[model samples]
Target: MEKKKVKNIFVEGPISAAFIGESIAKHSSNTNIGAHSIFLGQVRSDVLGENVVQSIEYTTYADMALEKMAEIREEIFAKHALTCMHIHHSLGIISAGEICLFVFTSSKRRRAAVDACTEVVERIKNELPVWGKEIFADKTHQWKENTL
Candidate 1:
């Protein structure tokens, strides 16, 4: 069987609540899905010395990131009985408390939904070619390091 390619997951600026809501609402017609797991990655304000992070400017090598995400998606589908999955990441500046990443997974069983969502999130953190610049309240910026 032929495999599907992963679509681009980048969204400009911060992801809005309305978009996320609509995404969930659209899944109402999928009767086969019994459970859904969603993960929202929000920017955090971190204090370093006298400066506090106000926002994060995200950048990525889009082509490479998408290819990597596609690999992850295929692996997850093979390993888990997921009905569907969606991944969205933000580009540009996202303020603290704003959503930067949205990962949603649905499955016929709750365990598959939860496990697929968690694994996708972890893989993206470890594998994607995404970078962040932390913009501090003092106007200084520093490169971010992925902790996970």
Candidate 2:
């Protein structure tokens, strides 16, 4: 049996627009792909009492995260007719309004791509060992919790 290679999905700081554009552009030549679904997660400034969120510092257990991601990739591919899938998540400090997560999925049909993308995002949020520290404008911080 052939071993699957684990992909590194972590990107330092925030995800840039240019990087996302480049990633999309790279798939233009693949004629077999008929549909593409993309999801971008951004940091939002939420008011908690008197303090307002200014940024989020993200951290993860890299090795474990990658292992879990690889399993997810395999499962998603097995369940969906996906031609390609890409996931990128931010590490370090990401300011409000900055992109933190990017997920792209391509398939021969729209439904497969869309479903796979949504499932991958949900799994990442629910299963991954990534954590985020919400930093307030007043310099106070609190651990962030994942919400559906």
Candidate 3:
């Protein structure tokens, strides 16, 4: 099959697990993948010894986010011999402990798929311009960018 199965980029106003599953399924199909791996990122409570996180408000630098996601996808494709990959992240208010991002990858072998999936997720967190606000149980909040 052609290498076009790999998604160049995917941007959403609000992302979900179901949406990510479908996108990955479609991208991995008709390819020669022997294994598929997926990683789902959920916002969690607590930030540097603070109260429980009530919700997470995520924002982006608009065009920068798109550019960054595109770069991430391209880098993954360049470095991995994979069938396809898809990354989706939420764009609005997401409750704490709820999933906000997903990284899915497929390859001809299990090892490559797993490695590529891991790399893609790490890159997105490191390089994307997506900002998040952690809402505390007391109704206060603080902005945070992904570190490492």
Maximum-TM-score candidate:
2
Candidate 1 local Cα displacement, residue 107, angstroms: 0.3
Task: Report the C-alpha lDDT of model 3 over 9-104, residue by residue, as the tens digit.
Answer: 434444666776677667644667788898888878766575778788887776776766766677778888888776677777788767788777
lDDT of 3 at 29: 49
* Clashes (N, CA, C under 3 Å) per candidate: 0, 0, 0
TM-score of each: 0.95, 0.96, 0.80
Ranking by lDDT: 2, 1, 3
Off by over 4 Å in 2: 1-3
Model 2 TM-score (2 dp)? 0.96
lDDT of 2 by residue, 30-124 (tens): 99999999999999998999999999999999999999899999999999999999999999999999999999999998999999999999999
Relative to the true structure, candidate 3 reaches a TM of: 0.80
Model 3: CA > 4 A from native:
1-14, 24-31, 47-50
For model 1, give the RMSD to the true fold.
Answer: 1.8
* CA RMSD of all predictions: 1.8, 1.6, 4.5
Q: For model 1, how does the per-residue alpha-carbon lDDT over 31-137 read when each residue is reduced to its tens digit?
A: 99999999999999999989999999999999889988888999999999999999999999999999999999999989999999999999999999999999998
Measured with C-alpha atoms, the lDDT of residue 145 in candidate 3 is 63
Alpha carbon deviation, residue 33, candidate 2 (Å): 0.8
Give the better candidate number (2 or 3) by lDDT.
Answer: 2
